[model samples]
Target: MTPRPADQRFDVVVVGAGVIGTAIAARLSSTSARVCLLEATDDVAEGASKGNAGITSSYYAAPGTLESDVIATSYRRWDDVCRRLDVPFRRIGAVMAALTSDEADGLPGELANAKACGVAASIVSGDQARRLEPLIGPDCIQGLVLPDEGIIDPMRLCVGFAELAARNGVQVRFDSPVIDIESQDGRVVAVITPQARIETSFVVNAAGLFADQISELAGGTNFKMWPRKGEYWLIDRDWGRTLRHIVFAAPLPDSKGIHVVPTTNGTALLGPSVTDSDRRYDKTTDAEMLAHVTEKTKRLVPSVPMDRAIKAFAAIRPASEKKVRIEVDEVVPNLVHAINRSTGVSSSLGIADRVAELLAGAGLDLTVRTDALDHIPTVRRLLLDPEPETLAALDPRYTQVVCACEDVSAAEIQAALEMAVPARSIDGVRKRTRATAGRCQGSVCMAGVTFMCSLAQNRAPGDVVVTAAGTAGA
Candidate 1:
């Protein structure tokens, strides 16, 4: 791989390209500062941002916590942000059903917390909850209706933020892991990657699972972050219509419990069994855990078809010693630690705004850019409207279906390859274009997708990776 130019400098260097980092970068791009977004993975949203439940939670936090403020603020701005970026967002609402008396007893506190956080929530009887969501099981004794809560396409949200950031002149560098943070006079000077040393006065540690390590590298806080693995089962789109609302069981003290979420892309998702782990990179799902998740989810929403599950995946949430850590380092100036676990996606925009404010407070020049692009060009999905006659007339490649299951056209895949933050691998393309992420799960489309990826990357089919760093051939 070619090394990055040694003399490259930026006003702000953001570590991690997950939702928080990308959102921060996007916000910073509106300013005159030269910002750089660095991601360790080959593509954006490959970390915790890609997995887990994609719900924009509104009432999941305590009253006086940062999570509360951020989640509440993000709930209001989410739809507008998604609209501007042309990302899929739905205010489908969520139901936190209480099946037992112990769970029902917690509803009052949940409602109180939501009220204190300025979030509108209502405690409903089981019958009312069932009326709202007919699929909810008879075991539900009570429920909390968080009408403002919703789901989003996490991949699109991250990509849209990165794309808009790039459009506004933020340099997005993928596969650029911050190996070390060079500091001088108790302030960060530069972030050293293997390929290049990015000279910047300010560094934002949004590194998700590795935030603690990044903090230590910056000679800042001695915080410890353990990975909390949450596994999910993505039900087929056919069952998505059956589940109209995002349903949740009563929360555990440690976990939010398994959820039944209807995603924006017409798919129902279940599980996300929270299990604490020491392994930062362990995203493997356990069969037993998944079975437990199915049982728990089924109790809340009996209609959840476990057999229709198309995919099972896990994400590691960065569980800090504190609930969330969003503060400028006291020891290391110009280094902001923007870390959150479960609510990262929900609170991203709010956190971004706060981080920018912190950066400005720390003497970083943040003059508003006169020419900053507010909106990114929306990529038209041929699969969304596969009008063969009309689409073929517009682009000949549209007629050639690459992924029949997803109705993904050759033109769509080609367009993903040519995006601002172009897809580098088959999974990248899947995230961007939904090419091989259908019912087949790349069984039928993997070859074609890999071929397109290979063609785009100018590599042999054998050399092209289907997803991440390794797993190139098989």
Candidate 2:
């Protein structure tokens, strides 16, 4: 397919339309910066942004690292953003459990580290851990509790940021990968994408796993990104609320170990078993990994029925050199890096805020306006109970549950498409309204979702596609 035309010369060109890029773009939109958010994929959150546990993180991160500072600041700002955008967020709290004596010994240092990073946390015994999260394993010796920890639908968070940014005049271009970045006299001059050439004075590299590639394109090549693969499982909704907080296993040298999370959609999620892979784009679920996650999670929540697990999926974390690498490009002065490996999702908004401040202080013409990031608050697309008052306020089709498994209605799907940056694919709809992302994983709801999407987009069923590459039958 031929690439699209560039809308205009932008003041800032953000590569990668994942959660971080979207957030950065949204924050930039809050300023007078003319920004272009570009993505290789056809939709936002198509990379690391979509598949993680969606924990808002308690900032139990290592102190003195860029990750620590960004997460601490982001956690504070997240509450306001969630409220303003009407993003579903719950501060269900978090617990970092330690089982072995060695693990127990590490708690003080970790707690001390978190405190240094400005995270409000304290150590508690296994009994206290159980009190905080009743489903915790009895064998757990102790845990670090951060009451401010929480969870938010990461996909929705990205969409919300993109929508709000778009409303404020940020040009978002999907299916436009940055293949080249040109610099002149130590300043970034332009970004070359598959679609068009985007001329910009500044560039923010928030490309997640592809950060190294973008850096290379911009004339720096000191870093490399390794894909740390993580696999997860989702159980029924009734099973989700069984836990009151996010649970965690003590960290190891390479990665944060798997922990069970109760998601905002009322489904219990487990796994994210850490491993390494060479491939940058593989999300294949490993059976052995699934089995391992199930066993480990059962140990944490003995009452959880393994048979009830309804879904299994995997995601990759872009390991960014153990530390976050956010700095002005040494080779290209106008280029900035906003790469984080471990807590990218949790720290996305904060990083955006920092990047904005950094750019503004650098003498860029950035004007922060109240109306710049206009987020039109949306009604709950998946209102499980269609009370008369709700139906009266919502689109009429919401009364008909199109996806029985996820309880997504036709009106909900339509509203998702009608948003400022409405979903353009089944995955987008899944993220926005939970249309086909349930226990059946679209097996049951695929046809209905396709039909509804076709109707909403005014296309025949065959004209509607799952992604740009995959088409549907009419």
Candidate 3:
């Protein structure tokens, strides 16, 4: 890899390209700040952002906590934010179903918490729960209806934030991991990566899983970080179309319990059994855990079509002593720490605004930038309207169907590769266009995707890796 020219200067440097970091970068760029966003991988959302169920939660945390505040703030503006960013969001609402007396007992308290948090929620009878979600088990005793609970495409949200930030001239560096932080007199001055040393007025530590390392390296806070693995199954739209809203079993103190969630792309999600793991990057799915998840989810929706499942995967959220921290470091005056174990997607917008306030308080000029762009150009998806004659008229490549399962066309694949934060690997293309993410899971379309990636990225077909996880192309 080539090295960046030495010692580039910026007003701020955000340390990760996950949703939190990207959102912060996007928000900060709307200022006159010369910002830089650094990521370790070839593309964004390589961590928990890509792996988890994309639910933009609104009612999970305690009403008075920082987590709840951020989530509540973002929840109010979710529709506006999604519209401007062109991210697909569904405020389809969610139902927390209770099957036992103990579970039913918790619904009133949760409803009260929701009210205090300014969320619209109500307790309902078992019959009402079954009526709202026909798939709910007949055994459900009670339910809590949260009308503002939403779903969002985390991949697209991160992509949108990165693109908008880039549009505002924020320098985004991929494959650039911060190796060191240079500070003097308890103030951060520079971030050292393998390729460049970026001088900055302040640094935002939003590295997600590896955030502790960043905080420690900056001589700031001392916090430990680990992975809490959650495994999930993705079902095809055949079964996905049957679900009307996101379904959840009454929450456990430690976990949200197993959920039956629907994706924006018309697929269903199940499992996501939470297991505490010490491994920071272990994403392997377990047969026992998956079995547990499948059985638990069935309690909420008995006919959870396991046979229609297309994929099984796992992602780990950052777990630490502090569940969430969004404050300036005590030891280092200019190092701002932003960490959230879960709900990073739900609270991203509010977190960005808070980080902006922290930066401005620390003496950075965050005057709203008039020149920054508010939106990116929108593209008409061929698959969304796959009228062959009409689509082929707009672009010849629209006629060339690349992924039969998702109906993704060559035109869409080309356009994904041409985005501001372009896809460079087969997996990147899948995230952008869903080419290999359908029923067959790339078995039928990997070659075509590899070819398209190779052609657009200007590499030999064999040179492109099948995934960012170092799976070499065959």
Candidate 2, residues 132-167, lDDT tens digits: the string is 888888888899887888889888889888888888
User: Candidate 2 regions off by >4 Å?
Assistant: 1-7, 384-389
The TM-score values for the models, in the order shown, are 0.95, 0.94, 0.96
- Per residue, candidate 3 scores C-alpha lDDT tens digits across 1-474 of 233444888989999999999999999889988999999998889888888788988867888999999998888787887778778788999999999999999999889989999999999998998899899998899989988999888898898899899988988899999998887778888899988888888999999989999998999888899999999999899889789889988888977888999998889999677778788978899889898988898888999889999989999998888888899998888999888888899999989989999989989888887778988766556555545568877888988889999888999889889988888888888888889999999889988888888889788888887776664445
The models' CA-based lDDT, in order, is 0.86, 0.81, 0.87
lDDT of candidate 1 at residue 212, scale 0 to 100:
86
Q: lDDT for model 2, on a 0 to 1 scale?
A: 0.81
Q: What order do you get sorting by lDDT, best first? A: 3, 1, 2
Root mean square deviation (Cα) for candidate 2: 2.7
Clashes of each: 0, 1, 0
Candidate that scores best on TM-score: 3
Q: Model 3, stretches more than 4 Å misplaced?
A: 1-6, 385-389, 471-474
User: How much does candidate 2 score in TM-score?
Assistant: 0.94
- Local accuracy of candidate 1 as per-residue lDDT tens digits, 1-474: 233445689989999999999999999999989999999989999888998678898867778778888887788888789888868888989889999999999999988988998888899999999999999999999999999888888998998999999988899998889998887788888888878888898999999989988999989989888998888888888888678888988888877888899877677888788788798878788999988988888888877777788989888888888767788998888899998988899999889989988999999999998989888876666645545468777788887889987788888899889889988888888888788888888899888988888888899898887778565576
Lowest-sum lDDT 10-residue window in model 2: 380-389
| Top-down TM-score ranking | 3, 1, 2
lDDT of 1: 0.86
lDDT of 3 at 219: 91
